[model samples]
Target: MRVLITGGTGFIGAEVVRQLVAEGGHDITVFHVSGSQRRLADVADRVTLIRGDVGNISHVLDAVKTARPQAIFHLGAILSTASDLDPSAAMHANVNGTFNVLEAARILDVPQVLFASSIGTYGLGMTGPHIDDLTVQRPLSFYGTAKLFGEGAGNFYRHRYGLDFRGIRFPGICGPGVRTPGAAQFHSWVVEECAKGRPYTIEVAPHTRVPIVYVRDAAAGVLALARAPRERLVQFNYLINGVPPTPSAEQLADAVRARVPGARIDFRVDPQRQAFIDRLMKPVDDRFAREEWGWNPAYDTDAMLDDFLAELAAHPQRYPD
Candidate 1:
């Protein structure tokens, strides 16, 4: 099957592209904006690279028409910080861009459309052990609001136009490569800081816990859902949560100390940053996705940390002091 992935050069998108390419027998074309090409240097030859913004409906439609992709993975969107700073841009990227992708899929008659939603949609005042699909979404930020809108839009298209849409509410995704400038950057920053043996500031408080997913597992989950049977997915806009492991600063520091003995980490609570993330930290339940698509995590906190340390060990230059 031929596939088209928007924002295919990003950290998470690149991981998805890597997995799709490795799966073989499927042709992949990545659509990215200017200056994003360098990020795809590793996979440029493996997949076709198209430069354009998803906000432009014509561009997206043209890409789909040109690629003739049976499946479309729309991962292009603005981050929390940028979204908060410039809400109009966020709206254009997250809201308008999503519409463009869905419209393109509708026009091209794409079989499956996978949209990347976030846990942020489940905003503040969520205090519980398990936040399942039934939980109401109370988005707090413009970014979250836009994501919620995207999900709703996709559902509308599915019901009215017979478009197959799947939504994945990703957690704090951690991995090597692009530096994701969002509320979840700390997930990867902690490892990068540890790799460099340098002291870094913690954005959120020590007790603040959020769901996290290894990049590889996140990529796999997207693919699985995209290919799942439509009958199995009764919910068009499904909220699939990745595994969330509570790794406070102390726990993360311990992990770092174990990997790089005497690693320095100064925990200075940033109230503003903490508030934004705290609003989105809720226990996630994924029984629906597990039963419907056999979605399971491949790595736990310990295994993830070990793998991160191993990757850093292999290339020390990337994380400089």
Candidate 2:
């Protein structure tokens, strides 16, 4: 398979790249901004690296033209904190950038385009024990709004142009090297800080619960959705949950402390951030994803934490404190 991945150096994108390389038979090309390729250092020799911004249509066009990939994994976008900080930049990078990718794929006749959407797409006004594929997406944040736009655009392209567009709405993607600021980032930071033998503070309350998927599972879910037969896909995009029972902040802290002995984790809830998290505490229902495309995550909480700590310890250079 000839594959092109945007934002391929990011936390989840990097994992996707590594998995593709390990799976073999993939001619991979990573379309990424400069200076962000640190995560690709290990697999630098295995894939072609193209430096470009997804916000730039010309860059997106050039990358698609150059790779002419069988599949384009569109994972590039400004995240929650950055998007909220500057809506204009997010408009360009997240909104316009998605348009550019879809346009490029349409013009170039790419067979499939996989997208990385988010659970952020569901915001206030959600009424259910858990959010499912059919839930109304009334995204509150700029980043969430942009992703919802991406999902809408993708559906348009798929119906209007017959493009094989598919997406996975991810929950909080937790893993090492997640430096991006967000209400849910503590999912990764608490574990990471403890792995480095440092005391860390959780900005949200101990009882706060946000559904999270380990980064590897996140990457794999996207790939699985991409690989599913078109006849089997009832929806163009699907929501995916990770692990089970949705661990609370206190449970997450306990897990970290258990793995990293003597790990000091404190909670000094920030009312503002807590409010932001409160809007996104709904557990995800990914039954559609599971039924449509074997979307089972390999790691439970213990398995995810064990692998995360092992990765941090084995490759300190990749995930520095």
Candidate 3:
């Protein structure tokens, strides 16, 4: 089956590409912006790399025609910080970008589309208890607003055009790949910094808790929903909680320190940064995804950190000399 993944060169998208290629025999096309980070360097030969913007209808239409993919993983979007700073850019990339993808899929009759939505869509001021599929989302950032809007558009496409749309609300995804710029950078940023034995300032308070997922598991969740039987998903969108290793910032720091002796961590809270991180770190239940699609993450917080350090340690040269 041919699969076209927008933002296929990103952290999660790169893992998705690896998983798909490892699974074998599927034609893959990566839709990338002109000068965006190209994380798909390893699979350059395996995937049909197409340069285009998901915000443009013609770009998407042409890619759709060229790939003729049965499934689409729509992972393209601006990050929380970037969106908050320049909402117009976020709107163009997230909202308009999603519209283009959904419209193209509707026009081409793509079988399934796994749209990437963030836990940030859960809104600001969430206190206690894990958010579920039924939780009301009062997004506090443009990025979240755009994601929520994308979910709504996906629902519209599904109901109006019979397009199979599946939305996955992801936690902060972390792993060894291209470093993404966003408010949630704290999750993987600290890990990378600590692994390199480099001192870094943590933007959030130590106790700030947020859900996180290893890139591999996040990609796995997407693939699972993409391959799930359409009849199984009665609900339009699925909120998947990737396990929060230990939401405490100190706990994450300790894990890093333990891995890299004498790793330095200074607490310097960025108010605006904290706002975005707070929502994602809020406790949210994922029983819906579990009951609906048997979705469960393979790594806990400790496991994720261990895996991350192991990967980095195995290849010390991957980082700057």
Candidate 4:
């Protein structure tokens, strides 16, 4: 399979590229903006890398034309914190970038396009303990709004153009070397800091809970969805949960302490950040993803932590202090 991945040098995107290289049949092209390719250095020899921004239609068109990919995994976008900081930049990157990818795929006759959506698509005023695939999406942040728009646009492309457009609404993706600044990022940093024998603080309250997926599971789940039989999919986009039973801040900290003896983990609540989490901490129901496409995560919390630490230890250069 010939595949092109936007944002293929990012955290999850890098993992996807690595996995594809390991799987051994596909020819992969990574489309990314100018920046460090450190995340992909290990697999750099195996895949083709292209420098470009998804927000630019010309760049998108050229990438698709050159790669002639059968599949395009559209993972490029402005994340929450950055989006909130500059809404205009977010609009150009997140919203326009998605449109550019979809249009390019349609024009170039790409058979399948997989989108990366987010839990932020569901916001305050949601009236359920767990938000499912069918829940109304009224995203509070510009980032979430853009993701929701991607879902809608993908559905439109699927129905109107006979494109195999699929998307996954992922929860907080946790793993090693998460440098992105966001309220939920602590889920990753707590473990990473502890693994480095450095003191880490949980900004949110101890009891605050949120769903998270290990980065590897996230990459696998999206790829699995992309490869599933099209007829089996009742919906174009699906919500997916990672791990089981969402963990509180304290529970996660305790888990880390258990693994790394004498790990220093403390909580000093940031009311503003806690409020941000409180509004969007509901568990997600991904039954549709499981039943329709056989989505199953390989790691539980403990296993995820173990592998995360091992990766940081083994590849200390990949994630530097």
What TM-score fits each model? 0.93, 0.98, 0.92, 0.98
> Which candidate model has the greater TM-score, 1 or 2?
2
Reference-based lDDT, residue 274, model 3: 87
Against the reference, the lDDT scores of all candidates come to 0.79, 0.90, 0.81, 0.91
| Cα misplacement distance, residue 249 of candidate 3 (Å) | 0.8
State residue 119's C-alpha deviation in candidate 1, in Å.
Answer: 0.8
lDDT of 3 at 118: 85
Which is the better candidate, 1 or 4, if ranked by lDDT?
4
TM-score of 1: 0.93
Clash counts for the predictions, in order:
0, 0, 6, 0
* Window of ten residues with lowest summed lDDT in model 2: 33-42
lDDT tens digits, residues 1-321, model 3? Answer: 899999887767877898999999999999878464445555689989898988889999999999999999999877777888999888889999999999899889888788999887877556657678888888877888999999999999888898889999987777764354776677788888867777888888888876777888999999988887777776768887667444677888887787778888888999977875654556768887887787989988778888888877775543432
Q: Which scores higher on lDDT, 2 or 3? A: 2
Residue 49, model 1: lDDT of 88
Summarize candidate 2's per-residue lDDT along 89-108 as a digit string, tens digits: 99999999999999999999
RMSD of each: 2.2, 1.0, 2.2, 0.9
Candidate 4: tens digits of C-alpha lDDT, residues 1-321: 999999999988999999999999999999999588988898899899999989999999999999999999999888889998999999999999999999999998999999999988988678987899888889899899999999999999998999999999989999998887987899999999888889999988899888899999999997899899999999778898886887888999999999999899999999899888888778788999999999999988899999999999889988987
Mark the 10 consecutive residues where model 3 has the least summed lDDT.
34-43
